[model samples]
Target: MARNRILPIFVPHWGCPHQCVFCDQRTISGCHRPVTATDVTRLLTEALPLAGQGAEVAFYGGSFTAIPAEQQQELLDAVGPFLRTKAVGSVRVSTRPDTITPETLERLWRGGVRTVELGCQSMDDAVLKASGRGHGREVVAPAVALLRQYGFSVVLQMMTGLPAQTDESALKTAWALAALQPDGVRLYPTVVVRGTVLAERYADGSYRPQTLEEATALGAEILECFLRRAIPVLRIGLQPSEELAKSVVAGPYHPALGELVKSRVYRNRAQALLETVTPGSDTVLAVAPNRVSLMTGQKRCNINWLRQRYGLHSLRIVQEPMEDWEIRLQSSESLDKINR
Candidate 1:
């Protein structure tokens, strides 16, 4: 199968200035220790044989640009040989919105970094402060502009249901991020982890994470906004890992959260399409094979939804022969007529 090979090197909280109220990087990242240059080199050596071309070395789980210059260079230098040998295609890293600077961008460029992802959690200043993000939305705008000026692909990461965040604020954040013209975005709804202040608040009834259904609906809205702007949403939820699962105190956490959101979007689209058909009319719906699961929804939710909304008890869903995102619908009359 064709894939964009990525070797994720987790740098958990290496240069984070403060522990955000909702952050326990070690738990969320599933890596408890900072990765050293030696560690990176060792990992690369072991991974290179298995990694073909088109592999990217990704530095994740911390504000990479905020890390000390010497340490940053050490890690970059360790990956340099692999890049030169064509074992790795490019470098990508994630950092806090406030961490980008001229010098930081220059260093990253020199190190052959091609993509920079910013953790711009929320655009509302109150929400940012409440979440202990240490920087406001104002900080992300210029950082995004500067990263673009430096010729790097920029990706903005946003969160919903953060402390002091509302549905309006979340939508506003998405609009504001769209204004920046980022090449990509990642939408992560807040998840309360053990040992975090958010978890304490959850215990005390002072905070609540968005419900799975609520989050999926919100994420669908956000996805539509970005899709309209032609911005790729690289991710939609926190990736599930054993360590991350262990750290969760409570919240809308799902191993297949991204798939769930996508399925919700598909169901919405399917419903819209079904609306064009006459009520109580039987129809057969065909979609791509890969999308069959999504169109069907989890445990036939989509099928049931279509049945209820369109009042069609004899709806049939089939996999299309050779198409993606192409759906064909036929009534019994058409099927009979075609066969005749």
Candidate 2:
């Protein structure tokens, strides 16, 4: 397992010119107020001793580069001592794609910001406009290129089920992001939070959040595409927080959103195996014990889905000395019974 550590510091909606339709950063980030340099210093002083060596300090919940230069430097300076001592490896920040520029990249590079995550919600211009994202898809590619040119690791964040977004469009967006070759990706399925335009739209029946099942399936597909390209998926869903949970008015905002996506992937894998097995053949599926929960979904949803979809009634899953994500299947009948 990777040994890198991360300390997240929230800057709720900093440098935000206007509220996006689905934004409620205060609620989502669980930090309603701006953080000062002193706050950053105190947080690091308290967290550093507890963190592993080579930990990275992350600034999230706002457009870091777009924030005032003085304030940005103040926040960066607070962590400068630690970085110089090698107590912290580097700094990371999330910002809107449009907020990035050559100058911003240079400033961040000079301040030890080694990673930049762009909130490229969707790559479809229409979806971007409908979701009230000020920038279009065209803005993200160049931003990513610029960040990479500055020798900074680039992470792309995408959302599903946004206003005017369809599964096809979302897939297209994922493909575009893949083409950008970002070092990491984050998938955040849209959820309606209180005090956002989305909440009102939901109340008025103009917008509906993606159902849990739909989001899980779509997220699985998105994850698979990135995995195929060898891109690290930094996050699969929003980190659930008390503030965010209570504020959520609708949508698939499961606390274990990552687990849900894993379950869907397992289900897809199981189905693929079943398709190759002849009808009435008995099959025993083997997976790591720890993955049983994810393979079965929250409540055997995957198992039930398999039964209904493939007439796979005589299936058995056993724990094996295998990796978490891999599965093996053995058939009771002749090997020829394998349809494939």
Report how far off residue 323 is in candidate 2 (Å): 5.6
Candidate 2 deviation (Cα RMSD): 3.3
Q: Give the total clashing residue pairs for model 2.
A: 0
Q: Write the per-residue lDDT of candidate 1 for residues 167-195, one digit (tens) a residue.
A: 98999999999989998899998899999
Q: Which one wins on TM-score?
A: 1
How much lDDT does each candidate structure score? Answer: 0.87, 0.86
Q: Cα lDDT of model 1 overall?
A: 0.87
Give candidates' CA RMSD values in order: 2.2, 3.3
Model 2 CA lDDT for position 153: 86
